[model samples]
Target chain A: MNDLAFRLRDARATLSAVAVFVALFALYTLNHPAGFSANVVQTAANKGVLLAFVAVGQTFVVLTAGIDLSVGAVFILANCLASVVVTGSPGAVALGVAAVLGTGLACGLANGALVVYGRLQPIVATIASGAIYFGLALALRPEPGGDVDSTLADAVTGQLAFGVPASAVVLLAVMLLVWVPFRRSLIGRAVYAVGSAEASAYLSGLPIRRARLLAYASAGLFSAMGGLMLAFFTYSGEASASNASTYTLDSIAAIVIGGVSLFGGAGSAVGAVFGALIFRTINDLLFVFDLDPLWQPLFLGLVLLGAVSLGSARLLRLKNRLELFGS
Target chain B: MTVPTTPVAPAPASPPMSAPARRRFDPAVATAFGCIVALLLLGSLYSTRFLSPDYLLQQLQVGSFLALVATGLMVVVLLGQIDLSVPWIVTVGGMMATAAAGHGPLGAALAIPFGVLCGVAFGLFNGLGVAYLRVPSMIFTLGVDAVAQGLMVLKTGGSAPQDMATPLMRDLATGRALGPVPNAVWVWLLVGTATSFLLSRTTYGRAVYAVGNREAAAYLSGVRTRRVTLAAFALSGGLSALSGALLAGYSGKAYQGMGDGYLLPAIAAVVLGGTSILGGRGTYLGTTAGVILITLLQSILSVVQMPDAGRQVIYGAVILAMLLLYGRGAKIGA
Candidate 1:
């Protein structure tokens, strides 16, 4: 294939994910009673951004062919910590933000350590660490009532110029600062190499350990950002088990929809962000169509199944049955 | 310059076949049993009643439910896959059984099987996706779990179901017909024996292990790998549901979220028993020991009046520590 054609082929999954998101989001907006208003867009953006952040975090770990079940727990931990610490003074709020972020980083690093050094599988290690993080969150906010800095929360959640959501802007800034840099960095490339073929990557003398550690650490940072956004939106913190589990599952779903291969070594945070947006839109579409709220889970489940099935269609093209086992 | 090629040695007519080495007992099972004993001793320190036959039997009864769920999970794990749908499938089993029981005599009599059948159906769906479509079992089962949760929610309208367990179900879950042994324990023993027989003696069971170790190699060796995968998942679904049904009986009614607590504990039990999460290398006996260990630990925690947070922390810590101790060498390439 020609270079341009090769690039396009490489980008096909992400492009398709974007297209799907646009189509669903358009359908969602058009069916709404208040058609295409900034208020509606802002509300949607605010909701979508939370999952988008978590999905971005998930993208990093997944890119390294590792899963982080503890992302949601870390998010909750950050939220709980933010609620308590992000209150006092402007300086104190800044410190609180740093503390929350640091905690997330530490959690991510801890998970990386367990997986890399302890040699535990990502799924089980995260499950165990997730429990620990959640336990800490529960201890921090046993009753679920804590405060955030109102001015900051309002400002961040509020709209900016041209009715663009501030949260969306922050997400963009994050993408530019975190995602772009990582994508261009040596360790980032190593992450992809490791995910694609760990044995080969190791043989090639790639920094597999550092790459994985960075991937996990970035996941933690992004999840913390998500948690911080959640606190801003809610103005309080809750160590809700359902919320934690739901977000973790939803992030994985979003990544799949965004065209990231769960098998790893492909896709992007951009795709994951769109996937998160697409998922949020699906939920809102039900609201616009006057479906019973009870139908939401069923609808979401069906959409996920359909999306996953579509992704698996390529398996039918495999000539050798052996190809199906490893991939 | 003349290049010299090395002469090829003649191949041996046939290499002598050596008898298979006798399998040794797994140290992990021993470790799990050791933990169980330690937990029992710790419990006895807190309360003299811990050693009583009634209390120990009660613990056994509770542990039986977990054992059943773990049995199914172990099968799937043996196939190198996982079923995250256990929690919701367990709920489906309980709800469907209880719902059926509210109908008539026939419905009451068939309630348990009905629940198990529903579980099997869901399991088959999971199997179809993983085995045929080749969707990753983790993600596929997770989606199935969501779908199950949605269906149950729709069925119950977000409230507790009205149907109570039938007398037979309750008797199966709680009653001790054979002196001092809970009926649940009896049920578990029966299931365990059947599973042990299947794993050790049946071609299909051997196929499950072979497929789990290397699906490609197993397929090359004439194993119906896809069928094995499907069957394992179905078994997992059915057993998880059976556990749910028994739990509903223990509680006298099925409720929403009744199965939410089983998924992790089931996986943990299987792994603690030395079933490699990667699949193909575990025993039914190890899982039994692991279940008992977990139950005793839980009992001890409750006895000490640890808060939920502390329990969670300790539970996670113990799992992590145990994993680090024995689960360190099996590394994922990624």
Candidate 2:
């Protein structure tokens, strides 16, 4: 009973995020012109999964009480690289995937090395690295053009049997294969420990630096996965500054809505996936209602602000105001 | 695993020298000056025209916009909080000023102040969220930024805004004054003077540094930390708005995304000035040097016709180098 209770407590944020996502999704489908069809679901899933992968990658870093502002740039970089390479035969496509993932790992490692070894702040370090990554992307694809293997892209992005979305399944598989094992491992626990209290984690002999480095590496890997997905979806690569920035901002929002604390040491990738889905639903809702797309940012902004305010509501109950500064 | 230590000069002056006075004469300021001199020499290698008084003054004029934004950023950062809403607040100021000026004579008269007032209001909202509600400043300010962008978009119907700047604004921003100096430089000097005075002479400034150094401790010492945070954010907002308005005037029109370029550079300038990103240490003089350096760098990059990618790469690399250099001994995070 005690174990179950602790588990529930641990998953509280994720559960809340799930509830919010379900509610938003229901409203979206009810109002969607197509009305809960598999087609709508697939389209939404495909879009949401892009951000989901990025947000999940972000979760790894945020869990360690740090942030990776370069995820979007890395995503764009991987997309550009994949567009150039993820063509030809199956063997060639496989190699291309490996190369793209490797590039992402290198980027993440660079960010980790700067933060952990060079002793720069994560925010500033990532901002700098993000620019570098975007620069590389721009150099690779100054203008959007290139191709992915159509067969591979179709297989991955296409619908599965029973009218299910393949992308949603991929997201689940990723969670099971990557996130579950990470969450169960000692190193994963170290990531959480470091995020919760870096000094305490260090004093307790946790390998904080290694955990942090791994977190960043995984972030890079996942964002690269997102990039590959983007290549598959778009059938080409474009090094778009606006898209990169939007993804970066949206990933943060998704993480927040997904119940992952920005301060770290808590939350799950599952929550983040749900957050991304909810965010996507907002776009669908806007579309279905036929409102001017101009109002989208405003509506989204209000929701984001509301969600953030809700998260901070606990502060009002604090007896001592000084505690506010510490958190 | 070697920790870098900042080597402090060992009591070179007399014992009677005050600690604040000593800090005011930080070696960072000296380094900033050194960097300006070195960069200028580098610029001269490109052409003698780079060293011309007219060219240097032109660069200073261009840099003033960044310097103004950095002034406000320095205040909020000094309190260990950041304002990411700077971009849209700048837009709001510029757009509002331009729209108002289009309304006729009275509107033209109120245009600049009107834009600045919008910034102050937005800043207050940011302050309320971070200070009163205790939202983390980063996320809160970002949310505010999104809302501001949305509002601006809605106001302009997602196209380029229609209004242009008043002649007065254009003159203030781009006109020549005192013979050779650009009017923008004069405006920057005014903002700089007020900022320096606020940081050095006022009790509130002392409160800001103290709160930034350690907010909980400052509260314990009876400082109203919340009020200090609110004021800092408000000042930051107002300044960002003022800068935006100036930018609009300089460009001769207000548009949808005029504020985008200033956000990162403003933060970069503040941090480059040796003001701790983590807060509680820095000087406006250093920020001034930082603004000048960044502006000159931009001019040089443009002169060399470096592609956008190359420029971004250099910018990011330089920022990382600066962070490593300045923050070698600074302890960051909660």
Candidate 3:
């Protein structure tokens, strides 16, 4: 029994979601034999890819027991800037992708500067940065239209072997890339340490500010990656409306549901990937069912509420068991 | 943790506290004085309408609502937790008021308490979640916001409610006393004064600061830790509800996102007014000053015809600067 639990994933919050995904996928296959076909798989992969990236970014911030509430704005800002530079030309497309990522790094750097050197709390610091970024995105585009090279779009949204989706493969690659630093690097350990206890970390003289700066910056870099995928999904960028605003909450929800504590410390890259996959699974299932847009938020909220409640319940049961045996 | 001055943390803690918290008064007064004087100069220099009595009164009028909501948000921040659900709570409060008004003013007046009670109910919910469940306040409040938004959507059907407040309800928002001042201003004074008194002169206030400083220590010292947390959230929720009702009474038409704009400013005002974002080191008086400073700044910027986008940047920057200025104590709880 213990071995089975060991074999299972660590982030317990996501289990029920995984089960739900399985159920939904089962339901979809039953309802439509074609739903499990290649086209649907690609569509689902393409749709969830950007959000998965954003959730990945959110994971980094959340690991430090902080939230990047500005992820949506950061995503929008990057894509919108990229839209300005990238049109029909392939060179323009390459340049645009670079611009989008650079935009994300710059925004992340600004957040890092305020949070580290400026001595601001992560929550307020991000909210303020988010506000500024939103304004900048608005000022840059004022309207919601941008050009993307069709070829570039095709490349990103294309596929790999065994009918595996391109977006899915890229997402996996990104996850693998991020895990390298998080699992093996000094910065990774520092992140968990700071998130666990800032005071203790400070006492340990672990360059706490630098660690936090890197965490926030890396989170921003992922936001850029998410934005690139997001632009490709629609093949456009626009700042006229609160574009991708939903992803802010969605990304955080994914992180939380992935079994990361909001209080920071104790999470895994696998957990975040699973979390994003779970969230996207729901969206994909909903699309398969042809549910109305209004239901999306309500459903998302309910699923998240269930996942978090399950976590609390599990902890409570564990405490009760310990108490019973101890007595 | 190098201090720019003599390192004070190493000193025995009890002795420094009673060196008269009053001794720290001069800088505060000077800062408030400087802010006021700067506003006056800017107002006079920038526009022909600045010194006009009507313009000043109009700005004061608008500031009153923000002041009321910020006052409520300040109460919770005092306890080292935040209330992200405030805007929607106010919206719901307004909705409840309008719903109650179908019967009469007596009915609408009854709704005021109900609105406040609803807020308290949510606050208690927040307190329980944060204190007992050991969940982060940020996620919990964000959830509360979603639930409240859901409730509003269910109640109003994605549009402003058809109901308006009864006459008595409207009077609280719009009713004026003596000259140009509105009734909301009077209510603000009442709430601000009462809160200031409670925070300064009451045992509950001290307990709040104690818990905020360190919950475990406060719990060990025999404070009813759970009750204190609940009361803090309850007060925040109730105040937000009252302000919401006051808003509904004044505006007569409650829209969905009206409370949205108040969220950031409410937090910003408390921080700007020299309250630590981390709790146990701020006063209602400072928050009150912050409310004034922020409202004045917004009004001034608008009067100067700054673009809406530019104003957001300036607002964010100013708030960031203020947080850096006075934030002290242990890091704030999530």
Candidate 4:
């Protein structure tokens, strides 16, 4: 009975967010010019997957009660590096992919080291690292033009059999390979324990530091994957500060919409993916409805505020005002 | 629901000292002073022109803008909260002031106040979200930021404004009085002094620090934590808006994204001034020094012809190094 209750509680936020997304997606499909068509789905999938990968990364760090503001920087860094390195022969492209991912891991490790060992606040530390990463990206691609391995890019970004999005398939493959294994691992449980109650987790002899480190490192790895996908989509690299900052903000929005608590310790990468899709669909919905592009930011802001307000509804029921501070 | 056996304790380990010592000397201020002197020496090595009053004062004029924004950010930071709506609030202030100025003499005269009031109103919205709604300040301010951006975009119709700054604004921003000192520097000094007084001398200031240290405890001890939070945020907004209005005056017109570059630097400046990022500890003098340091650093970087990428890298590295240095002593999230 206790185990059942725990599972239900854990799933509640994710479930509600999913319900909201489903309704919105339905609304989007109904209004779109080519309603429910493969082309529409593929386009939405392509756009959504980039944020999904980054949101998944954000989930890892936020789950540990920390945030990785550097994810977007790493994403852009990977994009620039990949554009430069992922050209030439097929063999060379593979090496480039590895190198891009490796750089992302290094960035994540740097953030983790500062937060865990140097004892700097996660937000500020990542903000600093993010600047460095973005600087490196700007140096790599001073202008916006570069070439990627077209064959590899096309294979990953194109439609699969029967009009399925190859991007969607790749996203699923990633979840299976990365998130699922981590979710089941002992370290995964420790990540939750630490977020929920650090003192208790420490008392239980958990490898608290290692769990936090792994969470940050994995976040970096996923962010790099997102970057690679971005390069594939654009077929070039642009070190635009505005774009990097937007992605960072959007990733946070995705996590919130996906039912991940900013206060930490609950949510899944799958839920985050759903959240990213929902956020992207909102943008797509604007297009279908023919709203002014100027209205998009305002509409997004309202949605975010409403979602956050809804999340805070639990505060009203508290008996002690002290609980208000913690919540 | 069963409460955990051991309650999650707050992170106050060994307080930096047994009691808050009333030390006349702050190491942060002293260090900042030293850095300023060191930089002057270093820059003179590049060119004798660097030591000229005209050149140094010019840097101060520009530094004044950042110092104004940092003043507000420091207040919010003191409450252990952050306000990310600064960029847009700034834009709104400048836009509103400049747009208002085009109407009539009254509009021109009230342009600065009109801009500041706009910021105060937005700050109230930010405050309500944080204090009353219990929304996290970071996310709430970000949402406010987007809303502000949209409003500005709609108002401007996706282009530069058709209006320009009034003569009064132009004078306040660019005109110099007292011979060598730019008018903006005087304005910055005035704002800095007022902020220092508010943070160090007033009852509200004491309440701010108390709330920052521990909100629940402060509340229990009869501090109106919500009111303090609301006031701090409002003040922060007003100051940021004031800076924006001055910037409009400086440039002689309002433009989009005028405040984009200020956000990170303002935050960094406040932190550099020895104001804790986590809040409840810091001084305005430190922030002032930090602003000067940052401005001088920018001048130095540009003199060397470093690319934008290199400048950003150095800024980021500086933030990280400062945090590590300051944070090592504080038991953050142990």
Clashes of each: 0, 0, 0, 0
Residue B22 lDDT in candidate 1:
18
By lDDT, the candidates rank as 1, 2, 4, 3
Q: Which scores greater on DockQ, model 3 or model 4?
A: 4
What DockQ, between 0 and 1, does each candidate earn? Answer: 0.64, 0.63, 0.34, 0.56
**Model 4 DockQ, alpha carbons vs. true complex:** 0.56
Rank candidates by DockQ, best first: 1, 2, 4, 3
Query: In candidate 3, which residue ranges exceed 4 Å CA deviation?
Result: A1-34, A158-163, A199-205, A240-245, A280-299, A314-327, B1-19, B22-33, B104-106, B158-161, B328-334
Chain A superposition TM-score, candidate 2: 0.98
Q: Lowest summed lDDT over 10 consecutive residues: which window, candidate 1 chain A?
A: A307-316
Error of 3 at B104 (Å): 5.0
How accurate locally is residue A43 in candidate 1, as Cα lDDT from 0 to 100? 99
Where does model 1 exceed 4 Å of error? B1-22, B158-162, B330-334
Span of ten consecutive residues with least summed lDDT in model 4 chain A: A307-316
RMSD of 4: 4.5
Clashing pairs in 4: none
Error of 4 at A22 (Å): 1.7
For A15-57, candidate 3 gives per-residue lDDT tens digits of 7555655676667666664857777778767876777788878
- Sort the candidates on TM-score, descending order: 1, 2, 4, 3
Alpha-carbon deviation at A312 in model 1, angstroms = 2.7
